[model samples]
Target chain A: MNGLKQHYAKIIVWAILLTIPYWFTYIGGYLGLANEIVIYALAAMALNFLLGFTGVLSFGHAAFFGLGAYGTALTIKFLVPSTLVGLAVGVLTATVAGMVIGALIIKRRGVYFAMATIAFGQLFFFIANRWNSVTGGDDGVGNWHRMPINLGFTTIPLFHNSLVYYYFTLLLFALAVGAMGLLLDGPFGRSLMAIRENERRARFLGINIELHVWISFVISTAICGLAGGMLALLDNFVNPRDLRFDLSGVLVVMAVMGGMRSFWGPLLGAAIFQWLREVLSSHTPNWQTYIGIVFVLVVLFFRRGILGFKLSTVKS
Target chain B: MAQLLLFDISNGLITGAFYALMALGLSMILNLSGVINFAHGGFLTLGAYFAYVLQQKIGFFGALLIAPMITALLGLLVERVLIRPLYGRDPLYSLLLTFGLAFILVDGVRIIWGPGSPPYQVPEWLTSPLSSTYFFLTGYRVFMVVLVVTAVAALFYVLNYTKLGLRIRAGTKDLETLSTLGVNTRILRNLNFGLGIYLAGLAGALAAGFLGLSPALGTALLMPSFVAIIIGGLGSLLGTLLGGLLIGVAVGLTTVFYPAASEAVIYVMLGLVLVLRPRGLLGEEGRLH
Candidate 1:
């Protein structure tokens, strides 16, 4: 019965997501906003791969995410006009960045690790901000959009049609999510969980803690880069803000709000956060305060998140 | 050429002094409470803004002294209400709470201050360069360095000579044992948080005179302090101080030859420091781990 319920949950989630493009407008969200939610959800889930699954706190994921954006943007803007190549370059860039940064901070633990990550994340932001000639600097890299996909005989116009782009993104999201789900169910993911539970015990059990963490960090960043690439494609622009620590913090908040431990929690969290941001920003200028208040409230009271809450009766 | 180098070094030291002031507060809270206090920048901004507002009524010196105290009180209150409960939980919760609070504070400042750089005036004499040959030695810069020295000295005196200081040092080393010794750790943590915030506020007030009163003022200064703490090594106040000074000089020197890489130079220094000394320059082994 439990297995059946889990199966039902997966089906329901996929069903809802598959139909979002159709019903999103009726729910006061545009297709672009839906794409954004999915992309952000992908990034948040990627962050959760480290924060929740591995029990490692990385406030620097934005560096990878931004790298993905800049990589995709710069690639398409200057290097190539192909959307697929742009995305591959974006992910590859984030992967290389993650590998280097992960190796650097592999030995640091707890808050030190988090601090190092934040500082490193800001390094990229500064680089992007200061490297104005190549990066377009603070103004952001613009005047380029995602090109159409040419599958030999057929061409899909990703630039002109938002719906086509949305489906394309959804397909990529499924592949990434599927890969993550498989990894989480496998041995490597189990080792990450062990490290999260107790590093000393995991170390005692002969698990290579640092190696596992570095790998987890790299995987999370690479996935986050994919999300960043999608974001750049969605907007056809990438800015230094993408690499800023604030976005990193926001990604962490999304994971926590949706219940980091739960596999799909960040998706729900991202959806809620994106929808609220859309609605709130339109209604009031002090939307960030409201979002911040939500953050405080979540950390204070709803830390278990929507999925984390349990309805159990206590017998006294 | 020598004069130019000297000018940059002095300028770097000035900025480094500011970083030390802020970093010392951050290191204090991290040592004692195990909280990163991301809202520290927020508090610093608040202090600067408070000074800006108070300067109108009571003048510069009066505002400078009172503004940080108000910010400290607010910090104390926040610790009691928001941070107190999160103690003994995963440090992640406190970090997140503070991170969120930073967001609120930044937005709140924007709402109140109208998102523009407010004109923060020092005395007329302070604005003028004290030496004709050394044009960079503005009276304001010298006065800022003096205040920073005085603040650091006062801080050291309090830590070394006072009972509260004794308890804070003890707590940073071993909060659990400090609590076992019946230190009323609740109050200790609260006061420690307040004291750290007080430094931030003070730094903010002084920083406003140089950087001008903008919402971004705290953020611009925030990353350098983190680098300072990292370079100095965690759990060492003196190390933090040295780290700040080192980075300031590094940045100052870089600006002379490579203006574009000036900001990036400190980070490069941080990388080199991390590689050369992982635990930080003065960080003790197994202190925070």
Candidate 2:
């Protein structure tokens, strides 16, 4: 019966997601907004890969996410205008950055590790903010947008159509989520869990702690990069704020709010947060105060998240 | 040319002292309680603003003494109410909590003061140049240095000689042992947290005299202090001091050559330290990890 319930739950979630745009339109949710929610959800989930599953706190994931956006934007603007190629560049840049930064901070643990990541993240922001000619400086990297996907004989124009773009973003989200699911269920994923549970025990069991953590960090950052690329494509613009520490903090909050210990937690957190932001910002000018209060409340009270709450209650 | 160089270097040292002062507070909190105090900057902004408020009533000298005490009192309240509950949880909780508190304090200050740089008056006695040739050597600059030195020295004296200081030092090394020895670890952490905030408050007041008072002032100083803590090693106050000074000078020197890279240089220094010495210059192995 429990197995049956779990299977039904997955199907329900998929059904809702697959038709999320339609439901949004049904309930007065904007199509463009729905698309944004999907994009941010993907990013938040990528952050959770390191935080929830791996038991690591990375306050610097925005650096990679923003790198992906810039890489894709720069590639499309200066090199090829192909959407696929732009995404490839974005992923490549973010993954490479992740590997280099991972090497530097992988040895440190806890708050020290978080601090190093923030410093490096800020370093990247400084570069982007200063390089006026190439990066457009504080004006941000714009004037380039996502191109049509060429399938040799056929093409899909995802340039400006909201519905088409939402589907395309969802497609990417599905692929990334599926891949994460596979990883979390595999031996390598289990090793991350081991590290998360107890570093000493994992090290004693012959797990190369540094190597495993490096890979996890790279994978998480790479996927975050992919989400960033998708985000740039969706908005047809990329700015430095995308890579700023505040965004990173939001991602962390999203993961924790959704329940870091469980899969799908970050996605839900993203949904609620995005929705709340939309509602509150429209209603009040002190939206930041409201959002900050929410973060505090989540930390103080709702660390288990909605999904976690459900699972625990059912078990009890 | 030499005089200019001396001026810039001296300016750098002064900036470094402020960084050391700010970072030292952050380091103290981290070393003792394992909380990063993301709101350290917020506390700093408040301290500056508190001085501004008190200056209207008590004047500069009295404000300097009272404002930090108020900030310290707030710190104690926050530690007792918010932080104490999370002592047994992951360090991440405290980090995020302080992060939320940072947002609250920053926005709260903005709401109360309006988001702008408010000109603050240093005492008239401290503004005159010490030498005609070195116009940059204002009495205020010297006073700021002397005040910082005195504060840091007093801090060290307390840490070395006082019963509370010894307990904090020992607790940083081993809370479990300290607790077992019949010491109230909770009070120890609470007092230590207050002490750190007092330093942050002091740094804020000193900083306002130079940078001017603004809601954004703390935000600018916060990251460099983190870099200082990281470069000096997370667990070592002396290392934090050295790291702050080193980066300040590096940033100062960079301004002479590559103006654009001044902010970026500290990050580069951080990366180099991470690569070459992950434990930091004074960080003990396996202490923070």
Candidate 3:
């Protein structure tokens, strides 16, 4: 009986997530709040796709996330009013950038790779921050919002109904998450794991380690782009802050704090982190220090993360 | 045009000295302990604040001498308490811990000193302009350059001649062997970390005069230092020193040609270095992998 219940844990977790918006009323939380958590959770999961599974650490992934957001926002404001089209363009642009950068920096591993990503990532941020003409510079482009999703027969009124937008965002998040799951269960995923486990052994066994790392980088950022598109819609604005190293650091911390080794670990991490930030910020102005304290604790004790601990301590 | 170019070059040389000074310390830490000290900028900020406090009482010369040493003591304490245990672990923990430490230090300085820039006074002799034709070449800038040169010379002398430097170099090359040969690796690393922080503190004190005393002092200088190390190549101190000067000059030239891209150009140089020679200009081959 216990084994049967354990097998259905994933379904149970997904159901809980799907119904959170409805039950959020009981906890005095609004739809917008739940939506934000889902968006961050998805973003954290995307980061884990690279950090946890691929065994690569990227310190500046916000470049792609912010790119997707700006692409979506700019496309909607200047090019098209269709949110669907905006999202597609945003993801497409982010993927291309990721492919190019991943190809360039994938030659290095570990800390050097992280440093390279930070440098490359900061380049985009500085451009966005300085190019006031196109990017609107530091204040970020405002007076723009996500358009209603046009489904040919019936338009999804995402702007008016918060619940509708939540479901729509959740649908895309599910698809992105599903894609990652499938990829991780395949031979390519096995190759990535092999490299992470032992690069020397993997190289000797005929795997092109750099190519695999590049692919992982591209794939991870592509999903991050989708989340970024959702994020632009969530906040109705995209700024250089979205592209900053701070957000990249947050995503990595979320992945590690939640359990980098487990698939759902980052989602849990994102929820905990977002909640902690919200609660702490509301209560005290020194929330950043507290967050730093949290980071210190996680590094020192919970390196394996919450799920990692649970898996070891709990019997099925 | 020639005059403007000369002025920028002179200025660039001074800025390059700052980069080389800071990057040398960073390279020392990176070489000896494969950990990227993300809070290095925090140390720089702390050094600046300490000088700000000390200079008010003792004036520039005394504060300049003592502030960095105090910061080094703090660095020693921090390395022992926070950074020591994570030494042999995955480099990720050290990186994250320091990243977190950066937040604490930056915020702590802000809380203690307030967020705005505090008034910084350099000695009048140092601040006076050298010539009406070259008003940009102030005595302070010259002093900064000479001091940097002297410090670099001192560092090289220690590394080449001293028993500590010999042991550090040997340990960096082959730690397992160094440990087997009866050297106290722990003390070596702790002192090395202190020495590295001492340089950061010195750079911070010098920067406070030009940039003004602020909480944000260290972060602004940190990235370019990283670029210098990357451009110079890892493992070779000469590479880092050369890398800092090269980027400093590049930034100076870029300011003249495309002022908007003065900062971005360093990152671009980093990208070029990585793509062209992943090992870096003076970096030992295979250290990157």
| Top lDDT hit | 1
Quality of candidate 1's docking, in CAPRI categories? medium
Model 2 lDDT, residue B18, Cα: 83
lDDT of 2 by residue, A1-316 (tens): 1556657866876887788877786776788788878888899999899987887889988999999999999999999998989999999999999999998888888878887777787777878888888888899988888898778898787886667788888888999989987898899999998988888899999999889888989999999999999888888888888898778888999888888877777888898999899998999877877887887888789867766644231110
Docking class of 2: medium
Regions of candidate 3 where Cα sits further than 4 Å from its true position: A1-7, A309-316
Over 4 Å off, model 1: A309-316
Could you tell me every candidate's TM-score relative to the true structure? 0.97, 0.96, 0.96
lDDT of every model, 2 decimals: 0.90, 0.86, 0.85
Question: What is candidate 2's lDDT per residue for B62-171, written digit by digit as tens?
Answer: 99999999999999999999988877678887888888888888888888998887878898878988899988899988988899999999999999999999999999
Native interface contacts kept by each candidate, as a fraction: 0.47, 0.47, 0.38
Model 3 agreement with the true structure over B73-152: per-residue lDDT tens digits? 99999899988988887677787888888878988898888999988889888888989888888999888888889999
Alpha-carbon error at B95 in model 2, in Å? 0.7
Task: Assess the local accuracy of residue A280 in candidate 1 as a C-alpha lDDT between 0 and 100.
Answer: 94
On residues A84-130, what C-alpha lDDT tens digit does candidate 1 reach at each position?
99999999999999998898888988888888888888988989999
Off by over 4 Å in 2: A1-6, A26-28, A309-316
Model 2 CA lDDT for position B86: 77
